[model samples]
Every structure is written in structure tokens, then in C-alpha cells.
Target: MFYHLLFPLSEHYALFNVFKYITFRSAYATVTALLISFIFGGWVIRKLEQMQIGETIDTDGPQHHQKKSGTPTMGGVLVLTAIVIPTLLWADLSNRMVLLALLGTVWMGVIGFIDDYLKVVKKRPKGMIGRFKLVGQVSYGLILGSILYFGGNGDFVAHTSVPFLKDVFINWGWFYIPLVILVVTGTSNAVNLADGLDGLAIGLSSLAFAGYAVIAYLTGHAVFADYLNLLNLPEAGELTVYCAAVVGAGIGFLWFNAHPARIFMGDTGSLALGGALGTVAILVKKEFLLVVIGGMFVAEALSVMAQVTWFKRTGGKRLFRMAPLHHHFELTGWSETQVVVRFWIIGVLLLLLGMSSIKLQ
Candidate 1:
């Protein structure tokens, strides 16, 4: 909004020219989102408390979590607010990539909001039916995939850039849509599963978004993309602002969401953030690198899958003490803080490794 409103005045005012820079806009987007989250975090938490929108901890989990059963949840509303408002304010609204990313985030957020509403507000144990949630995710993925496939120009369509390999791209033809759906849905659920501990998911998410912000900027810049041997999508630069908003919102949310959390983000945050990240990665042609960048989330999702598969195969046996890798560490005598910080350390390592690919190629 600011870009559209002020950049035109650059002809008249020299300062207005600053709005033309994606870096400048992205930096301000981060600041704007941080300020929004900080200013509204307390009010939102209080409102959730007043409305009794508290969490319902599962009895099967760690005993320590039981004490958090009534903490204000669905704070993803604040996160979404922080992300969307800043993106709209700082990003080029006409950019297709930015619009698509925001659409995906808000779409998943709505689905998550419904699930949280049912589970927490209505006291429904099952929340959103599994199939319904999956349907929502799949539908959004289909929409996004179709748009990217149909609207893409020339060689960029239906192809993905391979990391750690110079100028390597795989043309998926019609299969690109399926990959998009899979990535979007899989990432959305993975982040949802990883949201078990306070500050865990958001902490890792901020790191992931920070990494992607750089990737988006580089990918969209012709000179950098050529120098780095990266796939250049000129319009993608605007996504940096959106990614920065997520990073800022994640950090701001962490202020209250750290250990001994005052609030929980619930599915609203997890699913939306995951989906948004997936969308940005796809837009920037960093789909494969997303796995490297968000390896913690991948491992967390895989642990649950492995646990379920092993339990079914062995009739009552288990793989980990608990599903989701973090809970396993928690059950192994690691404090909640220990597990969170260790995972964050691992996340940082993965981020650096992923960043190295930008140059290693």
C-alpha cells in the first residue's frame, strides 16, 4: 500500500524513491510487523483470556504440559495480523508472487482458525475432521499449483530449480501441480505437528523465514541470480517483504511464546506459516532447499510417521517415548528449555547449510 501510494511521488520528492527498494521495504516490513505484534500481543492475549480461548492439553503428553491447559491459544490471529498487515503495507501489491503467498497463508489460517474454534471454543475433542482439513489444504494447493502452471511464462513454467547443482532444473510438465500440492499440504501438516513446545515452532519458523528472505531477494535479482547461478524470477523480489513479516512476527510472538508461555499459536499459526513458507519457496524456485532449511520440521513430522508405523507393526510397541522428536527428547530427561534450544541450534545449522548451497552451486 505504501509502495503504491508513495512510490509515484518519487518524481516530486527524493525521499519517496526509497520505497522502490525491496530491501528497504523488506526491512521496514520487519520493523512494522514487530511493532504490530508487540503493541497488540498483550491486548490479544487478554482478549483470548477473557473469551476463555485456552488450550486443551492432551493427557497422553508430558505431565508438565497439563499446567498449561488453560493458557490463551489461537494467538496465530496475532501472527497472521502481523504478517498480512506488513506485507500489504510494504510489498508491491501488484506482484503476483506476493499476492499468492499472502493468499496461501490466509487460506490455511482460516482453516486452522476453524479447527481451533471447534476444538478450543466449542470444546470439540476431534476439532476439524481430518479429511476436511486435508481437503482444505489440497484445494488451496490445487489453486496455487494451477495458477503457477498456467500463468508462468516460457521455460520457468512447470520446472523446479535443483539446489547444489549449477543451472540444474527439472521440468515436471503436468506433474508440477502435484508437487505443489504435496509440498504445500505436507509442509502445512509438518509445522502443525512440530508446534508442541513453547517457542519451539516459532523459533525455528523465524529462522526458516529469515533464510528464505535472503533467497527470495537473490532469486529475484537478475545480477545476484546470475552470479549465484540461481533461478531468476524478477517478480519474486517482493516476496522478501512477506518473508520478513513472518520473521518479525515469529520473533515478536516469541516474546510471549518462550518457555513458560503466556499463549499458544495453535494450528492457526503452524499451518498458515508452513503453507506460506512452502508458497514462497515455490515462488523462488527453492522447493528442494526448503527441506534443508526446515529440516527440523521435516524430522518432527517424520518422527510421528515413524512412531505410528512402528506401533502398528509391533502391535503395542513404540519407536520413540513420544511422537514428534522434541517430545522424545523431553521424555528422555531433557528439560523443555533444553529440547527447544537444542532444536533451535540444529535449525541454525540447517539454515547455514542451506545457505551454503546458494554459493556451493
Candidate 2:
């Protein structure tokens, strides 16, 4: 909105031209989201408190987590709100990819909100069952698959881009549908698993968004995309505004979500963020690189699956002291803060490595 109003007058006022630049607008979006998060953090937390919404830590997990029993949850809603509001205010709404990403954000957030509500308000022991969450995720995947398949506006499945290879666009044709499902489902759950600690998941998500902002900008630029041998996505530059919004929102949420967090993201934040992450990657044709950039999420999710699968395969045996990787550290005497920070460091490193792939070729 501001872009439309201000950028046109760029010729008349030198200051107005800043709105025409993706970089400048992205920075503005980031700052706007950060301010929204800080200003409204208390209100959101207060509402959660009034509603008595709290996380129900499983009895099988770390003993220390029990102390966090009554903390507010579903804080991801605030983060999403901050991001969406800023993006809408600063982004070019006519961009189809941006619209789709916004839709993905709201859709996943609604599903997650319902799950959190069931757990927090209705007091279900496990929150919405695993089957329900899986169904929601699969449904989201199908929605995206259809959009990529039949949404003529975005009708270009030329091939998936590989980061550091020459002539390496991997086309999937009909197989792309299954790949879409896998990407959506895998990313949603991976981030979900990584949300074990207060600020871990959101922090990593912030870093990933920062990297993706640059990727989107580069892919949308013909010269840069050509130089890096990346997929040239024409309308992708606007996505940087949304990515910056997320980066800002994450930082804002971290103000309250950090160690001894006042609230948790719960499924509301994690699932939605994961979906948003995957959707952006798909738009940028960087779906394959997600595994590298979001390595923390993958490691966390894998730890849980491996632990459960190995336990069932053997008699009363397990893989880690706990699952989700971070819990295992907690069980091994590392403080929750330590695990979160160390994982954050890993997230930052992975993001750099992922970024390097574009130039590594």
C-alpha cells in the first residue's frame, strides 16, 4: 500500500524513491514487524493468560519441563500477525506468489490455532491427535500441489533447482505432486519438532527467513540469477518483503519467547512457520536447499522418528535420552538454554552454508 502511494512520487521527492527499492522496503517491513511484536507482545500474552492456555508437556519428557506447565502458548499467532500486517502494508499485493504465501500462512495458522485451542481450552491430554495434524498437513500439501499444478498464473514446473550444479534443473512432471506433499509434510513436522525450547525454533526460523530474503532477491534479479546459475523467477522479488517481515516478527517474539519464556509457539507457530518456509522455497525454486538451510529442523525431527522407530524395533530400547534432539541434551544435563543457543548457532552456520551453495558453483 505504501509502496504504491510513495513509489510513484519518487520522481518528485527523492525520499519517496526508497519505497521503490526492494531492499529498502524489506528493511522497513522488518522494522515494522519488530515494532508490532514489541508493542503487542504484552496484549497477546495477557490474552493467553486470561484464557488459561498452557502447554501440556508429556510425562515421558524432561523433568524440568514440567515446571513450564502453566506458561502461555500459541504465541506463534502473534508472530504471524506481526509479519502479515507489515507485509500487507508494504508488499505489492498483486504478486501471485506473495498472495499464495500469505494464504499458506493463514491456513496453517488456523489449523494450528484449533489444535492449540483443543489442548489449552478443552484440555485434551495430547492436543489434537496426530492423525488430525497429519491430515491438516497433507491437506495443506494438496492445496499447494494444486496451486503449482493448475494455477496457470504460477504454471512453471520447469524443474527443481539444485544449488551448485551446472544444467541441474530436476524436473518431476507428475512426480512433482508427491514431492510437493513430501515437502509440505516434512517441513511442517520438522519445525514442529524443533519448537521444543522457548526460542529455538523461532530463532532458527528468523535466520532462515533472512537467508531466503537474499535468495528471493537474487532469483528475482536476472543478472544475479544468471551469474549464480540459479533459477530465474520473475516476480519473486516481492517475497523479500514478507521474509523481512518474518525476520522482524521472530525477533519481536523472541523478546517474550526467550529463555524462561512467557509463552510458547506450540503447534500454532511451528506448523505455520514450517509451511511458510516450504512455500517460499518452492516459489524460489530452492526446495531442495531447504534440507541444508533448515538442517536444525531436520535433525530435531529425525531424532524423534529414529528414537521411536528404534524403540519399537528393539525390546524397550531407545535412540536418544529423549527425542527432538534438544530434549536429549536436557536429559543429559545440558540446560534448556544451552541446547537452544547451541542449536541456534548451528542454524546460523547452516544458513551461511546454504547461502554459499549459490556461489560455491
Report, for every candidate in turn, its global Cα lDDT versus the true structure.
0.94, 0.87
Stretches of candidate 2 above 4 Å error?
11-14, 153-158
Candidate 1, residues 1-361, lDDT tens digits: the string is: 9999999999999999999999999999999999999999999999999999999999999998899999999999999999999999999999999999999999999999999999998899789999999999999999999998888662567778788887788998888999999999999999999899999999999999999999999989999999998878898888999999999999999999998999999999999999998898888888999999999999999999999999999998999999998999999999999999999999999999999999988
Tens-digit lDDT track of model 2 for 126-173:
778889888888888888888777775433673787777766777787
Top candidate (TM-score)? 1
Q: In candidate 2, which residue pairs get closer than 3 Å at backbone N, Cα or C atoms, i.e. clash?
A: none
C-alpha positional error of residue 230 in candidate 1 after TM-score superposition, expressed in Å: 0.7
RMSD to the native, candidate 2? 1.6
- Model 1: residues with Cα > 4 Å off, grouped in runs: none
Indicate the residue-level lDDT of 100 in model 1. Answer: 98
